[model samples]
Target: KGKAFFVDLTLCTACRGCQVACKQWKDLPAEETRNVGSHQNPQDLSAKTIRLVRFNEVKEDGKLKWLFFPEQCRHCIEPPCKYIGNMYADGAVKQDPVTGAVIMTDKTKGITRLESWEMCPYNVPRRDEESGIWNKCDMCINRISKGMLPACVKSCPTGTMNFGDRDEMLALANARLAEVQKTNPDAYLADPEHVRVIYLCESAPENYHDRLVASAAQRKNLVAAAPKPKTVTRR
Candidate 1:
């Protein structure tokens, strides 16, 4: 049985404990950053920063509301990035059978960087300038294979992050959605059927991120506008 994550967006306080834990667990280098006018630092996801808590300030009913989105790879049930990567180099991107985790492998260095981003609806993949390899969240596969929760889930102080078998997580997500809906009727799950990582949203999914819910139009535009992949001369 594959594993899954149910993220209750309403419960996320933007404390970023999960973000710090991810870097600590992965031994990823710190990014040198200055205050960018918001609590969210480093701005966006990168090779070293796979998990990011995105912040957005919006006005709702004449009141200011801050939307915090702890974003990462959705690990699609059928990852299109895998197909796009295989088009250039086999095994560059793969979906792990056991955990349903989407992983960008070392073989990614043999593939074009643009195609990986072009096909990923969530825009999750990032290329390492030094290694020439693309990377993203792998669901902390090493820990989970040993029957442990992913580092982010384990570190979250709030009950925002939950992980378990796919079915169990799905049930939890739906249950949470129902409870949240009692207060916020607009609350719903974000593309639960298509992704292993499900998000329970308090409002429209787009309020968190435009790509929070993958759409056919977004995919079509991305593919149509994507520049031709530079030919890779495999060493």
Candidate 2:
């Protein structure tokens, strides 16, 4: 079965249990961050930080509404970055045949930094400043391979994060969408078909992030805009 992640944003209270769990499981170091005048810390994804909880304020009926998006790699079915990198090097990026997890390997070091990192639509990959090696979520492949859920999903106390078979996840997302639409007509799933990480958003996806939802037309345009192999050198 294909791997899947279900993120119920409405059920999330922004407690950040998943965020800390990611850091802990990855054994990543802490980043020195100043008050950015927002509840969000560090402000963005980095090589050492694979996951982050994004906080946004929106005005709904003249009242302030806070929206939280626990952001990470979507692990697309046909990952553009993996495709672009493989055009240049054999093993720069890998897709797990079992779980459909996208992994950036040490072999990525051989690929030109600009081409490999810039190819991602979600801007998920980060290159280490000193080593110039790229890094992103691997869907906790090591753990999943052992029959365990990803750390973030395991750590979420509010049941905001879930992992399972692809079909099951999609069904769950739709059910949650129906429930949310009772009060939130704008509730929808962001990029449900194209991505493994399904997000149940309560408002316009743009209010959370520009890349949160890639409409069918937008995706088609992106595929069209991608440079052909003959026109561009991979490395």
lDDT of each: 0.86, 0.84
TM-score, cand. 1 vs. native? 0.92
Q: Over the stretch 39-141, how does candidate 1's per-residue lDDT look in tens digits?
A: 8798889999999999988888899999999999998887777777666668888878889988889998866646345878898888898998888899999
TM-score of each: 0.92, 0.91
lDDT of 2 by residue, 1-235 (tens): 6899999999888998888999999898999999978898988889888898989999989999999999999998878778776665678899999889999998777556363234677777887777877788899999999999999999999999999999999999999999999998888898888899999998887888777865556545555566655566656
Give the clashing residue pairs of candidate 1, or none.
none
Q: Give the C-alpha miss distance for residue 130 in model 1, angstroms.
A: 1.5
lDDT for model 1, please.
0.86
Q: CA lDDT of 11 in candidate 2?
A: 89
Q: Give the residue spans of candidate 1 off by over 4 A.
A: 113-116, 216-235
